[model samples]
Target: MLVEPERTAYDLRFRLLGFPIRIHPLFWLGAALLGAFTLNMGFQYLLIWMAVVLVSLLVHELGHAVMFRWFGTNAAIVLYVFGGLAIPQAFVAGRWRRILISLAGPLAGFLLCAGVYVSNRQFHWASNPEGFLTGGREVGFFYLALLWVNLYWGILNLLPVFPLDGGQVSRELCGLVWGPRGTRIALQISLAVAVALVAYSLLCVLTANGPALAVVPWWLPRGTIFTAILFGLLAYTSYQLLQQLRWTDSSWDDRVPWER
Candidate 1:
């Protein structure tokens, strides 16, 4: 039925750096569906966004897979709507190794963003005084798209939220400090953060306010329904993770985050 297509789509595979890469069709479907919102930006920009997100996400996941391989095991990648996952055959031997692997993904994203930003600077978009007000010139639309998505998304991905790189990193850190109770501590921290984010998003949307701090960037996402939905999704995941606390150690590795 409906689930079959999704399964089949994600099952479509290829190889990257010798690791299997399975791309879920929803990735494309989600990007294509964004066309409605980008109608004013034109179909060309929509196409560019889709392509940029795909490539940037691939790079991010490759960072994880590459690091995983360093631990002497093969890994597989799954790219879907939100982003990608690099699942390894086994966890690395040490907590520091696991932390390094977790950090590698965001590091890759940062590097890719910097690379794109530098490559696009020659186009002279920044020289246009009116660039910021106009979303930059057409010549730099894709560049801006790539830069913003990679940079902002990469930074956001590093936030200490469960299943996120930063969250996983924090989890390992807590494990080092707290012993067997680290998992529960991590879950609690993630839930608190998720609740705060959800509350912030709701407050921004409902009260038309943002962080009171003067230094907070005005360009940071706020009061958007889309971001609200994202925070809502994160809240759901936080709830799920909280419920997963009872899981035994052996069951943890066998299931993916989405499954939990």
Candidate 2:
């Protein structure tokens, strides 16, 4: 799930801020499927959702790429089915530096969210005359979609699950504290968290509660069926990685210095 995808004939290639970007065919499909609910309103709304997703994901990946460059490594961005990947052409050595690079993606999203909020307040674009949040306003829906993806998706990506930014940080921190046993410990942590999220997502879906829970309050984020499937796959990936680590006779971690 975390591997970089191979290039395809249908891939859309471009450059932004000196960073090469490739958008796989599956990326559009994934974005569309995720925003399929918006189609109920109209086709135009779905297009807006796709545009929001494209801009948001591009920003997120650029965040990582910028950090990679700051660390003296060039990186390429790829938008694939699962999400996006910022693949470093050259490796950066330090654990702390890598952690920062991992964090840059979500932090970038937050910054964009803040910028959008500020712009809305300044122009009063967020105001809805129909007294509904979106109120059939394209501008309102655009702001809503942008904020929702950045804020919620940013938080979700920060969970201590394998292959996520938080998971990378957790692994590094564990390695610092636990020495050779840290990678396994991090994977264990990832598995537990992912499993818990999967269960919560299932509960939400089964009860038809969506992203709210009786105990979680309406304000706090919960999970949906998509989250359940995503976390379930992550949990299984963690389990597989843990098993591999267990079988390795050497004291080294799964990734080599370059791979890291």
Candidate 3:
């Protein structure tokens, strides 16, 4: 498999809350597109939903950043379309630390959902008509949607599939039993599982007969192409990891970088 390199418009270097951050231009472009598309809903309720989603994603990334820092690893978080990405410097060592970092993002999202649920239960936002009058029309629904999305996102990320945070956790855990070579093989299996998941999801979407098909905008094709590219990247990355493991096994010392 051939790996295609990522393209960028311009490199962005900045700092957030005293942490140095660098974002590729493509990431920013994706973020801008996401923001524009979301805000284009033109409804106050949707605007609130977009804000909550974006903020939740940021917090998810922040969870990774904080845990990475705690492990004495340099890391940066980038908010992009779909969700956020957390990149840790190569200096981050040890399997346990990697597992912690991988788990943090979803953990944060779960916590956010829990907090929202508690507030809703305590306040009875949905049951009271005065709640909307005081908080503006449909604000309660926005919060409900936000909480649901975050909770779902968090749980979905925990699936042991490739290119996802949970997949990394799976690799680390497998490393303990199978060592590096076995871990690499496990990742390839995970990729197969991911492909299956994508197929199943597409089937579900088609069977539901959602509005996605009827309202075929020009951007729909582009989105499909982008998704294909993402899957290709995941495939290539898994291949590369497998190759490295094979090389390690062939070597005299049999030392694998990914070994636990």
Candidate 4:
């Protein structure tokens, strides 16, 4: 008889090259939809770009995973639509280690981007139209686009806002000084920064005259539907963080030696 596998709170688990991995079913569903949409674009060369993106995301998450493992923390990698997540158990243990893990993702992405850039510059692919005019430029364009996407994604993830790598780094540094309470304050500040960014994104969408809102949809006007939903989600996440902070305060205060 085949033995049934153990289940965890997250979801189904699988082994990849002896490394345990668990993925929420929703993640695979989203990946399927994304692949379908990419296929519909009819850019056959985009498959190469997609492969590059997948590799970059994996490398990025690996940075976090390696650091977590080095610190003896249980960590799992989950790939999602935009990118991936590295959920490390006991992540709050050491401040500097936490900061290192947080920065590792973006560092890996940026390094990949640099390698692509150097290759492109050495090959002079973009400058040589003759190579494309004689044959086809699809591959060249795909690689260039991949480089840009990875570079932009790395920089974007570095933005100092909640749920971003930079924000996590900031939180970790603050935690060193303020203890668990400092993390709560940092989270609130990060959320505030996110709110400001969302507002600016909406403002840009509204000012632009278009059939639909460029960012979301025209039917969903700025501050009308999507914006409201965006803010609502942010608010909900902020509330959850606040609740977690409260629990941490009540429970950890007695056990942990805080700075203050």
Q: Write the per-residue lDDT of candidate 1 for residues 181-244, one digit (tens) a residue.
A: 7977887787788777777677776766735533547887664566667756776787776676
Model 2 lDDT-worst window of ten: 127-136
**Candidate 3 residues 27-135, lDDT tens each?**
5455455445446456665556666766677778888888988887767676544666777775678889889888999998889888877776677654453444334
Candidate 4 per-residue lDDT, tens place, 1-260, comes to 11122344767566543345655555545444444535645667446556666677777887788778878876677765455787776645767877888888888888888887686667765545344422246656566666766676677677665677887787777777787567787778777766765765566557654544455664432343344444546545766787887887777677645743
Cα lDDT over the full model 2 = 0.89
In angstroms, the error of model 2 at 63 is: 0.5
Give per-model TM-scores. 0.81, 0.91, 0.69, 0.68
lDDT of each: 0.74, 0.89, 0.66, 0.65
Angstrom error of the Cα, residue 177, model 1: value is 1.0
* Stretches of candidate 1 exceeding 4 Å from the true structure: 1-6, 9-12, 33-36, 122-138, 209-215, 246-260
RMSD of each: 6.4, 4.4, 7.0, 7.2
Residue 127 deviation, candidate 1, in Å? 6.6
List the candidates ranked by TM-score, beginning with the highest: 2, 1, 3, 4
Model 2 regions lying over 4 Å from their true place: 128-136, 210-212, 250-260
> How many clashing pairs per prediction, in order?
0, 0, 0, 3
Off by over 4 Å in 4: 1-46, 72-75, 88-92, 125-135, 209-232, 243-260
Deviation from truth (RMSD, Å), model 3: 7.0
Flag clash pairs in model 2.
none
Candidate 1 Cα lDDT to native: 0.74
